[model samples]
Target: MIWHSTGRSEDGVMCHPVDGESWQKFDVDYPNFSSEPRNIRLGLAGDGFNPFGNMCNPHSTWSVVLTTYNLPPWLCMKESSFMLALLIPGPKAPGKDIDVFLRPLVEELKFLWQSGIRIKDTATNTFFMMKAMLLWTINDFPARSSLSGWSGQGYRACPTCNEDTPSYRAVNKVVYIGHRRFLDADDPLRMSFKFNGQPETRPTPRHFTNEDIQEQLGRLILRKPGKHPNTLKENMDRQGFELNRSKRSIFFELEYWSSLQLKHNIDLMHVEKNVGESLLGTSMMNDKSKDTSKAREDLKNLNIRRNQWLQKRVYQIEKENSPEFHKELSALSMGSQMDVYTYTACIINGVRFMVLSRDAQRKTQNSGVLTVCENGEKYYGQLEEIMEVQYPYDYSTVIFRCKWFDTGDIPDDNFISIDTEKEAYQDDQLIYASQAKQVFYIREPVNHRRNQNNNPRCVVEHVNHQNIWDLPSDNARVQNAYSDSVQDVDNVEVENVDIVQKDSSPGARLFIEFSHTFKAMLT
Candidate 1:
């Protein structure tokens, strides 16, 4: 592990925290402190777990652990290297009250940073003042808020984006977007019409400096320790909205805390797990997925992703393809005397759909449809109408009428090009609502446009829907998403972007025993 101090492994891989910018910045700022590799550089990690493993009857037991980055990367994260600094027992998590329990540790850290303890170096047979600095805190997003005094929810939830976090109040939940702004300045995606129609020329949000954060803290009234912060509404007051800080974190008491380039780290495990679950739920189109009917509606409200809308449609198949499909039409079989009701919108398989007319009225085109044939062929169309037909026993089934765009050619290159000028299935245009999956279309950019007409040929994008496939368990889906993110980071896959691991560990035992006062306060 001593070789790790050289900053690069034998294979040229950066295998230690010593090679990172954060650690380098720390050294440049406090050269004296970093002069000795033996001088302790520590990280504090805290997380709550269910000891019982029974989620139904859960207990919040939090472990605060400290690790040193002085060791080589491989040995640093081993369980044996973990030093259990404090165990917070809880029938409930401490929340903001966690500061009360953390007071003893903060005081010790302050003492170590201010005045040093004398210790003999075993290898050199020389005595020196041993001192330590807490480089950063490590925790999941929720625990980070508790430890860092930053709220992890609402509009400014993302610490990196801060005030510039792009948020949309969806029909159901608040969602964050605008990752495209992080792209390169000349990236084509910045000017692409696929997302939200308008070009995203907004430069990346300004990174908050240490001075910026300190200025915010100067104006904030730190909340009392052990008391919960205000509700989201109350916190939206002028001061709270301006400065998202809930309290001045106890860590800021350390003299060197503000100078460190990175003050807190979001644990990769939690972030990856969350991102993975979101991907699986979406791919499987299940209830656990964030891509719900409300999500589609959110797209509509934002005037983006217009193709994702499930349109009210008349089901009509091409007579040449499904020749008998016209005979199955309820419209032809049932006379006008039969009661048929029309609806603008309906929910099917957790996917929300709107009629083409309704889609036009709303100015969001969601009426696209994609259907797969038994022979593996695919058809693309736009829904025209939605109808509910009454049966002899008063049973009812909804049907859709659609106008399918004509596919010009099955290209040798395997590209699908649809001609909006030509309609495909004219005579045979009817399908049971259950048989349809929503789809949307995007035209090739002007330079790449494959058609000559004003209405260019379009490409189809499937609207992710529920019940598409039998999905893996929650844990497995998360693992897949997490693994995918790690493997494909160079591709800029955003679903659940992985955070680079910054903290390292090695063997250590340094406990901050709780004082009687702290124990009494816990009780």
Candidate 2:
């Protein structure tokens, strides 16, 4: 058979093999271009025996060529590369015979390219990729009989099945190519071998079947096993894999297969480690090397101290400002009852004051008096009585009183009426009638005390007189008066007044007083 290089250089010299060697060279003959450059071609004889044994002599054939030239700048810096395809002459068989063999080789090349192997760098040169493709074809299939799995005479039966099946079946059977197929006694292609150069009559060895070969290959390719590093057993301890211990053989099979794959790539270590860490990181399992009991005890103590601190704060507030304390306590109680309390606060001026409750239940008991001091002075009050004045609206109205004014004196007459027409009397003209009588008049001296003793007394006419009754001489009367009048009025006023009590308890009474000066400040 003859081998030829297809593409031409510009020169008239044919771009052919230089000699019957592993390499060849040719020159490019440019007709009009000023630069004349030679291109190189390299070839490799593919592996596998040619059935005819008539293709270019395998050992002595030309495989590659490099031509001499004033190399281009790009080529001068580095050695040029080329892809080599070994051309095998087609058999004298009828119809599409060559194509049938070529297709499978091409498919295998494509598969190799897809598996993370870069065949070429487009930026550098396309030659490397082409070379990879050519390498795959040659390595995968050198000749038609290499694929057809038949001798030159096309009379050899399949080695595995020993049947006179189609050539295609013979190729597939002996080569162990394609997906595996399970066997059954009823199958037309049941295991059988050739005997005495003809189709065999008996079943072939089960081990020679396609299914058995594939199963063996699968086991060989696995990446994990009991004894392997990062093995299935180690992975189970680190991560974990569920398996039925009852099916020991099946379990071993899976692990063996997985281990084979692991050996081929250690990059899967990260994935294994992550999975293992996640499984082993659960909180339920305590580290045997650590003091787990001590840690738990410490957590318990911390919680106890936190609860004590909260109770102390509540007590202090209740003692200091009973009204505010009660309001907060009430709010907490209400929130607890409703089971919706999340946050509670009392803000004074722009500063936020917070009372924290652990949960809804704790909030119900939150109300109590809180005493707070400003400067050196201590003041006590209830939370509700403390007015909440917001910014911009009541900012200017916020005030605290440091001192108070003292007013002294009581009016003598409980009841008094004044007439506008009465003239003012001089001090000297006024006279005292009798010290014993609790009566006084304001009038001209001439008309004073006219009906009674003829002593002059000031008679003020058309003026209402206030009667002064003597105090009750006994405690019984006082008690009676208090029970009937004093108690009713005081109780009514206390109830109606918008006063905030300091104590949070329902029955506890605590009062907080803001002085009149403080009230004025609010306005």
Candidate 3:
């Protein structure tokens, strides 16, 4: 058959060959392939699923999917371009027996490698040969080890790197991987660890050659013994066809196939699934179920994040503060229960409580515009949204804190620089999880202090029944209150009486007191 002659031997062009295999031609194709034959650039993918969509079924089947990178992007993923390579019908997991199912594909691949299929070159009006090359394999995490002939667990768990996972045995011979640390003799901060009283040292990573790995299999038989043709075992062995698929996976003795690197990619979907499974299993297996510390260290390699409630951003009361304040803050629930207590002085249930408000600013009657000094650190930071936190020491007692951002994107129109009384407070989604016990007050220089504490802005007032105009004019009360500073005082009076009825008493009392000096001038 006439093949795609990349470099014409008749034209005196040097066509390099190694082990009886042509090299330069791989990059060139027949004229039928537009200009030259497209490089196979093939990706082999396999996944097992039930065709019946019966979850209750115990049987399983795997399908080998083949797609070529040579195709245009739009057509690459089309069903028409996806060629089926093999189907491994199964009632149970194939395990190493997978080689049995792969025999057909292997035989076909060998034939294609040595004697390619013949087809007429439409442009040249002549028959030429063409071959497809296996470039890479793509499989989920479970299949990674089987396909790559590499082990992904134990001390040498990592398939791609020589990072030896440091493992130790506990009371019952249970192996647990520990945190990896770089040995630094010069750095005093690096806590030194010892195993069996011997200082632990970083291991020098190991490297293995493909041939070295293949030899470790001892012997391999790629085909079924029962189906072995009358051909002698000695003959197949001599020709190296008797090797297991894992060893044969090196594609030994094949002209161009021997050198082609068959890369097996890790499918993220499966990796994520496995990681989640491992965490769930570990959690449920424990008596505490949510054993935060031990489980976190045991599977630290996964770098799994703690649940949202345990994350760092959740504000917590500082233990440095008095234990009573911290204890009180810790006991608060999501909503008002009893009353949450803060040290800042405020009125709740007609009783006073203490709380802290640094650089408190009064809200404008028209707009809630407040300002405070920037003490070295930001007061609120990015959490501009406001939330009211109810103290649990008494009923109707509450303090305001900075609400955390929502899981979804905060609409710019909702959270951005809009000055509105209605939008100042956050919508319901901003509520903190139960464990976020410490109040996270807003500290941003440009913070929107929402309608909290019944105060418009930072202006605070005590509700009293007494009226200012009703105070004694003799200034006796004011003089008695600040006797050391003032010799006299003035009784506050209403210049214009708009006498309003209070509970049909036809009178309301108000009191205002001033120093003698100011009182004498005003009167």
Candidate 4:
């Protein structure tokens, strides 16, 4: 069961003992052991006692050759177990290297297997149970002791040292400690700490400087545009809303105009034509009135007259005193006042005409003619006399006049004027008629008693002679019509007249006569 080295022989083979027997030149093979057998030869000699004689008497020498066998499994297993125990947990053995420890453990495992000891049975029955118990003690003891301080509170073990502590406080402490250590190692000015917590010198972390914090905060506050994918569509939609409002205004204006047209039933084309004609006429009148030669002559004549009157008045007033004259003159002098002139024109049918005029000097003649063409008929009058000027400056005006005549009587004239100036002119020409043929004088006032309360009454002068004709049923008539017929045509032939004959009875005769009279009056 034991292995002992005997000696090395001249043949250069190692001799060892096994099973308490000496082996020499023996073929020894052990599984997981030596691969070759070592051999040794022993010599013995016997001789008769020939005292002090290197005598010629000789004795025979004997060579003993022995064979050895492998040790038993039980014996080898026990030896291996003892070796493993000594290698693993024993004190440092003399003359043993790292290989010696490892090799013994390996040999023990192999011997245990050869002795029919299963590795799982040995681990569970003995070695593993003991190791597990030892590990449990080492892991649980510190954890149990630290529990009193950590009672009723959550705790996290330190990642580096595996010691129980409050998580955030532990992290902060470690960070500061690590920072201090790192600084002390690099900086000669900073004194390193011993077991005490106080620092002998100040230490700072360059990486955790104020500049780095500021840079990081600046990046957080000022973000790049379009970086967040989720916000891109929302931003785009907001921009689109702004764009749509501008585009929608045009559609709104169009709708407003259409509604206005529908409510007023205005013929836009007719309105435009009338406006153009009136503008043209006004321009013509302006050109004609701009003849400075006539205005200059009138101004000259007035100035001469005024100067003469002033000179005469001055001479008479001189009797009072020169001072009196000066005082009176100075009192009479007034500062210059700003004056403005505005002219407005409107078109009627194909003709252009002026509808309004405001002059600063109050000297400009207001008796300008306005010509209106309606339904292929021409009429002329002063705008001031015929229609009221509403907002003359804005050119918004209206004229109320009758559309048809019931009788031959002259209509009443209503005067409406908007005097915006500070001083009113009594001598201002109220109305003027151009193309005298189209002008008609109203000799009698119009009657409004029939529909006075119900209908709006307006007085319109007849611009056409044919419009003056009245039906026989109307009793009132102008008596001196022939005197004003100087411009009337004689024996004028008229078309579109119809005559009806009646029965020659008394009542029928009366009706026939009445009918004839009515026709004549209408004509």
Model 1 has an lDDT value of 0.66
Q: What is the C-alpha lDDT of each candidate?
A: 0.66, 0.27, 0.40, 0.26
Compared with the true structure, the alpha-carbon lDDT of candidate 4 equals 0.26
Error of 2 at 472 (Å): 99
* True-structure RMSD, every candidate: 23.0, 38.7, 22.4, 53.4
Candidate 2 per-residue lDDT over residues 1-523, each given as its tens digit:
0122223244755433222221221112212111211221222223233464667643322122122222332342244432333344433321113333344444544443233233544455653322111211111222322322222222223233323222322311322211123434455333221111122233333334435434433433223322455455534342111111111122122212222211111123455665566556533343432224443344233232222233445667877875556553433222111111112332121122222231123434221222223443322111222232222211111111111111122133443222213323222121111101111223233444475434433332222224322233453312121121111223343312221111223432222221112211222
- Model 2 off-target regions past 4 Å? 1-82, 85-142, 146-154, 157-162, 166-523
Best by TM-score: 1
Q: Estimate each model's TM-score.
A: 0.58, 0.13, 0.40, 0.13
Off by over 4 Å in 3: 1-36, 123-126, 162-207, 215-258, 272-523
Worst 10 residues of 4 by lDDT: 130-139
Stretches of candidate 4 off by over 4 Å are 1-224, 227-234, 239-370, 373-382, 385-438, 441-523
| Ranked candidates (lDDT, high to low) | 1, 3, 2, 4
Q: How many backbone clashes does candidate 3 have?
A: 30
Off by over 4 Å in 1: 1-4, 7-12, 228-238, 309-523
Clashing pairs in 4: 25-39, 274-347, 275-347, 277-351, 277-352, 278-346, 278-347, 278-352, 278-353, 281-352
Relative to the unseen true structure, what is the C-alpha lDDT of residue 347 in candidate 2, on a scale of 0 to 100? 19
Task: Compose the digit string of candidate 4's lDDT tens values, residues 1-523.
Answer: 1232332334654432232222321213222223222111111111113333544644322111111223333442242432112212212211112223334433533343234232233423532111000000011212222211111222332222212221322311321133343354556323422212234343333333335323333332222222366655544332321211111111112211112111111224455766676677555656523224443344233232222234345656777666557532322221111221112322222122333332122344322332334543333333332222212122212121211222222223443121122222233323211221232322233356654433333233433333232222422221122221111112222111111111222222111111011111111
Top of the candidates by lDDT: 1
